[model samples]
Target: METQIAGSIARMDGSTSQDAIFKDVLAYKEVLAHIMKTCVPEYKDCTIPQIIGYIEPNPQVGQVGLHPDETNPPKIQGMSTESTTTTEERVVYDVRFSAVAPGEDGKIGLIINIEAQSKYHPGYPLVKRAIYYCGRMLSAQYGSVFTQSHYGEIQKVYSIWICTRPPKERENTITSYTLQERHLVGHVTEPVRNYDLMNVTMICLGKPEGKHYGGLLRMLEVLFTGRYAAKEVIQILEDEYEFAHAHTMERTVSEMCNLSQGIFEEGMEKGMEKGIAQGIERGMEKGIAQGIEKGIAQGIERGMEKGIAQGIERGTNRERLQNIRSLMETTGWPAEQVMTAMKIPAADQPKYLKLLSLPQ
Candidate 1:
């Protein structure tokens, strides 16, 4: 019965890309709690409020508490729990948590970084990319741009990677890596040192089913596929009472179930006239993703399709710049690749390439 339900969700997600917005639901507490259960396992009992307070010493004031010198807000929002379909990094951190505060107001917590990667890069590998992100996180903690903070104030950073695609030489679907020291001289035990202050976890969605990760795979199904995995999501949550009560999963189901209303409203607001049908038709004719960019949203929002392109050709250069930026940010493609992929004009390519080199 549960398996049948999950199949329905997969089919639904196939049509609507709701799974692409896992970052939105992440703002909820229940979702964060279950994520913590999968990644750290240590804070399995920590509630939503505890997770918030632990991440920021003063959640009311929005203090990250990541560093003692960190009084002012960091430029990057310091805490981005959502996922954006942008051209930048796909770093989702419940997959990577850095701190954990234990029981009884013990104040044991971590400064965490979670990155979610839907696509795989064989050239760098997920592990290597994860290491780079973790290293950057570690270095960023050396001292704030403001006052100097001691290294002692640096909280443990956890870099967790959840990959929708499996990488080469993947040992297990879920593998945890910790620092270990070995002494071979006197046949003595290799002492596991405490000096290493960071940890990494890699979860591969394509891995074969094992003991514990089955539940995680199901959770991922919901996170990545939404309504397509709705049935299994319910079954999985039923098995875990806490997860069921959290309401994050339930909320996602509700949103997916109600999405038709939103689409209809959007079409109506866009006038749903000949333009609406034409825009949708163009989008389907091109590719839903590519069409969504130039078709309905842009077509309705701007009311010009070829005109936008002509403006570029005439060197007026407004929509062209906006489209390039939108594509770059949304797709995270290099300027050249984006150019080729989008079939940008040869003359326009040089201008676009130059734009990429300039700082955003």
Candidate 2:
């Protein structure tokens, strides 16, 4: 039960709602253009208006398909702000779209994917996942962007990751991994356009006062960190960056602030609950030991062990039930959802459900 509550608290701390809100803000054309102008080399010198024009009408957010079917790929259309491969191994991209890049001869198309990552180290190396996403984006372009034997027409792909919480050493850093040609033996040159098809950019954000806190990093920090109130953020966006969309930005910032506050309050409540539970458990253990000694003195030693075990079990069950009820009440979630969020086992759910249904 303690472990369950801790897990619930952790999930709430890094909740999907926060991620969704981040995605919502990032999906805006104005925000995306700012990011590309600051972080992407292709749009580094372009004006925000030009960059926004290059971006397609709508970027897909939380859509299916890292690998849509070659015969019938998902159509890139509409203005909704929100992909997967196979049915079993499908991957939904946080935000994916196509954009036009200025080239020497003509405009070139580029596929761009933007991800809002909450954790810097989520078990696996995030760079590998970014690379994999780039690969999938390139491969999924086969039937859509270019047909067989027309590999030259394949558009370049970029997977940009915005990590909200990175390790201290990697904080406020922007690293790019792209296909670069190295002369192994002789001075042979190849066109960059032919081979520079995949790129992964990792943008790790840290404290706003960090060394690298300027331009894109600072803008993202202000947006995601929830350090400033919505009005403060809006003022920064307007005065510092001259962002035009005040109302939209304000709404998004407000949503993020609200969610962050909720998570913080929930975490504090859970921490207090955990501290109280630990203290109660310690006291119960001490009392049980004293009772065992008294039982031995009273010549009831034969039943002491069984009685102690039952008492401990009952105490644990009561605590677990109380935790469940408290969570359900606080979250306004149903019993099933609360139990699922806490990661309670399916086998124990029926028993808990029965207990929960009984009168107090």
Candidate 3:
């Protein structure tokens, strides 16, 4: 039953099962608290419990924003994980919620959106997407957060992207882009709170062995990487990170690992089957072209062997080249950096570099 369920989950659309599991784990108050303290400037100095208290429970996961109508004005249209535009365009969020700022005033709150990004170079600039998300979040607040030009009531917005597989140079790093006040002439400054409403934070994660793999980086790596067993992950979270939700963590982590294994196994099986099919086809083709019984047999035997080997090799190399190109184009990484990060063989580096030099 477990295997069957895993298989079913593995077939979900575009890693949906894995993404859902990640959302389940991250939605935990304890986990959110850790992220808040480590990533959010407002909660940087707050205690874990304090941060947890500030976080509203049952954050909307995969929420969608509906277009406001006559009955439901924009002011009443609450925040959600996704929003539908007039043109039927959709913007979906992984996790979206509001958290009160840790202060005696208790008036300021943050509208936060958390995204679990599996790809680092997803065709376009991720930072720009993050900024766009921030913009959407801010604009979404027009009537819900504050109405009728009451801009002061506008809560700060944060779009935090946790990139699981980034380039080596960006591994285990957290960078934030926010509204910074730059003065060109006289040094007069407005209050930071007034203009610091939008923030985009990118947290790129690598393996746990890196020097910077400590604190939030290590914690997230352990939770999402599936490198360790569920029990071990839970133990680490509890002992090292002081996470108290042992049972929930264990269950979610275990589910994620099982689903990931299922997906991996399914992929491998498909790859092998495809390679074998190509080998058989090529073997038959060569045998027919020979037009001799003995020659046909020999041709098929050789073709089968060569085709199997070359099919898999070609597929792998093609994928590697695509990844390298994507990294270079999106991250602007030099060919050397991309090759090193991808661990391309020294002998093959020149070939790949040459291939990269050609115009796409």
Candidate 4:
């Protein structure tokens, strides 16, 4: 009797925007219930239909105006095409079910609101759950009041929080906050309603005993823990849940597997692009060094050729000049220093300095 439930799974980064996760989660409403029942045994008495009843249409809570028809009570319109009301997404599901316990007056009952949560948010989700429950109950009974209680006195508001992350010893402890009596100074007792607190109950599904949760645990073990789970957990995957049996669980398993593969491929493509960029940088460095060396070699070769050509011409024309230089050398400068100071044709000096500067 299970069918597709609406709502997506959050992305790997836990982004709820990815409709992919929601679509798959919606596809297996039965699985969702199984997990819930396992984690909270109180759910065994709670039917899926009841859970759906506790659930409001909108996943988010805020002021929303329902269509004229939605505002009307549930009734079969006898299949009339002229029924002017239309359904829209603006109507959010604020709850799954409203559990009522009879109050002392019996005229009004205590409302225990049950809200299912899977994604992580920074604020106290349970507080939202409490406020929404109170708001919905107030609105259902009293449209608006500047400042007064209506629909009889609120007996108690219970907010149940189901979370995906396990409670941490340092921070994630199971906690409940409520208005209680405490001594003002001595033995005199005073009630604390700091901002009208309600009974808030938080259950962190990420606990180690989380795996011990029947349906929810089985689902999470396969989805999160993977290969590291114990033998009993592995057996649960092999037996009760279809996500474990890759062959039998086609739709759910296939969808999750494909999504994971796509995410992996996307990461690899980005990495490859980075690697290619590094390779190109290295290649450019090598090319620049080679170009510089080739230019220097070409310049030296041209200079040496010009110098040899000039020396040959000077040798033929130098008898008078050469004898004059020999007579002037009587200045007694060391022969090596005199030779160094001699103005050689600019062409011959170029190749000599070029050869000397090259590393041996």
Report how far residue 68 has shifted in candidate 1, in Å: 31
Worst 10 residues of 4 by lDDT: 75-84
In angstroms, give how far residue 199 of model 3 lies from its true place.
Answer: 1.1
**CA lDDT scores, all candidates in order:** 0.55, 0.77, 0.77, 0.43
Q: How accurate is candidate 4 locally (lDDT)?
A: 0.43
lDDT of 3 by residue, 175-263 (tens): 99988999999899898888989988898988877878899999888777667788888788889988765554555568877765665
Model 2 lDDT-worst window of ten: 1-10
lDDT of 2 at 173: 96
Model 1, 239-353: lDDT tens per residue? 6534533332454554553552454466567876868799889878778677667677766756676777776676745566677778889999877777787787888799867
Clashing residue pairs in candidate 2 (N, C-alpha, C atoms within 3 angstroms): 60-82, 61-82, 63-83, 64-83, 64-84, 65-83, 65-84, 66-84
Off by over 4 Å in 3: 1-16, 57-79, 103-106, 261-360
Q: lDDT tens digits, residues 254-348, model 4? A: 44445544554776799899889988998898889898999999889988999998898667435433433464467666433433567555555
Looking at model 1, report the run of 10 residues with the lowest lDDT sum: 1-10
Q: What global local distance difference test value does model 2 have?
A: 0.77
Give per-model TM-scores: 0.47, 0.63, 0.64, 0.34
